[model samples]
Target: MADVKKVATRQSYGEALVELGAEHDDFVVLDADLAAATQTGKFKAAYPDRFFDAGIAESNMVGIAAGIATTGRVAFASTFAMFAAGRAFEQVRNSIGYPHLNVKIGATHAGISVGEDGATHQCNEDIALMRTIPGMTVIVPCDDVEAKAAVRAAYEMEGPVYMRFGRLAVPVVNDADSFEFEIGKGILMREGADVTIVACGLMVQASLEAAEALAAKGISAEVIDMHTIKPLDEDIILESAKKTGRVLTVEEHSVIGGLGDAVCAVLAEKNPVPVKKLGVNDVFGESGPAVDLLHKYGLDAEGVERAVEELLA
Candidate 1:
């Protein structure tokens, strides 16, 4: 696995923006002085005329993007997740989300994977905040392939799309040539009948590795990438839970209002099953190395495998 190719989803978002810029001229990008870190600098470099720098005001940047959509032009507001979803929550909910504008929010460096940036910059609550906005579509792609496709899909669709991109380089688990991405649709990565393991973002690859470990122990775990958080694919969760009898939800976020809670909500309504949530234990992140932080927070493959064994026991 060390030889496997890895790419950060934030990089994918930047590359995808450049590709989209070449194909369409109706969309403009706005950044809040973090264009380089957010990877929107690529789009800025390519289409300088179409890029807007709103200084350090993320709220104003979102508002500008919303204003751009009024003229029938799509706008992508790029910034770190903490600012885009946290600091700009009022503007995002009122300016973009309330009006249901065609604004695509590119939230990069999301989750605890933000590493040494610590709790203030590491956003584990963005998904919950974004989902609360009416008609806002939340997407957390698993790898480079899905991240690029998700960005393209958000552009083609008509509505406010909140996309979360990671700072950590994750394994390219999906085959670019064979993979297909759809908004609000979950992908069934590996099938099994014992227990279903659902994950998103960097956690998706960790879930896959956990599945393999479970298989070695004769646990037959099913793996799913719930890329789209809002308008979640309830049918897939019900179907997998029906077959597996149990489910586990994993994420690089807080357990309060992320992937785990979203999946549990569906199962509680449609089908009742035992669910083990593998994520941050309702706590803030500390400054540390990215890989070491994930291990400490129990968001890695070994942590996931251990959670599954405990759930089964």
Candidate 2:
């Protein structure tokens, strides 16, 4: 077996978009004046004419992308997660979600991974915002391979989609040949009966590490990469909860209205368990290193292990 290389989800989006643009002329790339920073510049370099820079006007950019989608184009609008979901939220809701446009919103720099850029740039609520919109497909890929697959999947699926990515380089859990990607399906990384750790985005890496740490201490922790937030994998979650009798959700977003809440809503309605959530506990982030911010907000692997211990206790 060959050693698998780990790639960041942001890089995956950049590489995948270029390939998609090359294959389909209908696939257009739009950026809100931050193409270079968001990594969409890769696509711009390949397909210059098909790329549109909206010059800081995220709202108008989303509207333009939605309009383009209506004209039989798969518009992929790229910007910071905060601006994409927070600034142009209304435009996305009305123009994209309302009309059910085939628009792919690739929002990068999500979570505190923006590091020294501070809270204003970090989007901890992007998932919650996108999930609330009607007819919106929300996804957070666990690694670079998954992110590329997600981009391809988003282009094929019809409807408004928001794909969130972070700024940091995370460990690649899944490789291109490891498994196939499916929308609304949960990937079970490790199986156990003591507890289930359902995580997304950067937290998926943390959760997997925590699961390994827990196993060293005689606790069997099942880890699930619940990448898709909207149209969540309910069956997998319910089954995990029923088998483990305990569940802990970890995310880079806030504990409220994010992946944790989404999992809780499903488990509560079906099979309720001792569910604990590890994330930003209702607070904004500060200017610092990405790993420091994660620790400060109690979202690191140690934090996840602590949450799992508490749930088991």
Candidate 3:
């Protein structure tokens, strides 16, 4: 196997948009002035006529996307996670979610991995916000490969979708040929019986590393990449929980309303088990290097391993 390249999921989203633009003429893109930063500039370059820069008005940008969707077009609105999910939330809820339009919100720079941008830029509640919207689909891709696949999936699916990516680069975890990207399905990256680690976005990589470390310590840890947040793959989660008897959910976002809560909600109803969540503990992030912040927040491989060890202990 070739060494996986490290690239930001946002970069993959941009490349995927260009490819999607070439494939579907009805696929239009809109960015709220942060084109280069959000990676929507690539789409603008590829399909200038189909792309629209909606200035800094994220609310208006989402409204414009909703309007465009009415014309039978799949509009992908791109912007920073903070503005897209927080600032323009009302517009997204009323204009887009209310109508159940075919609008895909490409929210990049999500979670603490945004780095150095401080708490304002780091969106820890995007998943929670999007999940609240009725009939809305939410996805947080693990790496560049999964991000591209998710972009394509969002375009193909109907109704409203919120796809989140981070500014920091993560290693590609999936192979193009073998990996099958499904909208609401969870991918079992590594199988084990002692415990299962369910993770999304950047945390999936850390979970995988933790699984390997655990295995060396004679602890068989299963790893599941739960890319999709809403309409979560309940079957896989329950199956894993039943098999392992213990579960751990990890994410780059807050442990409050992210993958952890979602997993617990299912397990609590279906099959009760001990579930530990590894993520930001309802605290705001500060300016620091991306990797440093991840480590400090206990979201890295070592952090995950320690969490798992303590959970099992």
The local distance difference test score of each candidate is: 0.94, 0.90, 0.93
The C-alpha TM-scores of every prediction are 0.99, 0.97, 0.98
lDDT tens readout by residue for model 3, 58-134: 99999999999999989999999999999999999999999899999999999998999999999999998899999
Scored by lDDT, the top model is 1
Clashing pairs in 3: none
RMSD of each: 0.7, 1.8, 1.2
> How many collisions per candidate?
0, 0, 0
Candidates ranked, most accurate by TM-score first: 1, 3, 2
The C-alpha stretches of model 3 lying farther than 4 A from their native spots are: 1-3
Could you give the candidate ranking by lDDT, starting with the highest?
Answer: 1, 3, 2
Per-residue accuracy of model 2 over 90-176 as CA lDDT, tens digit each = 999999999899999999999988899998998888899999999899999988888989999999998889999878887777766
Residue 271, candidate 3: C-alpha displacement in angstroms: 0.3
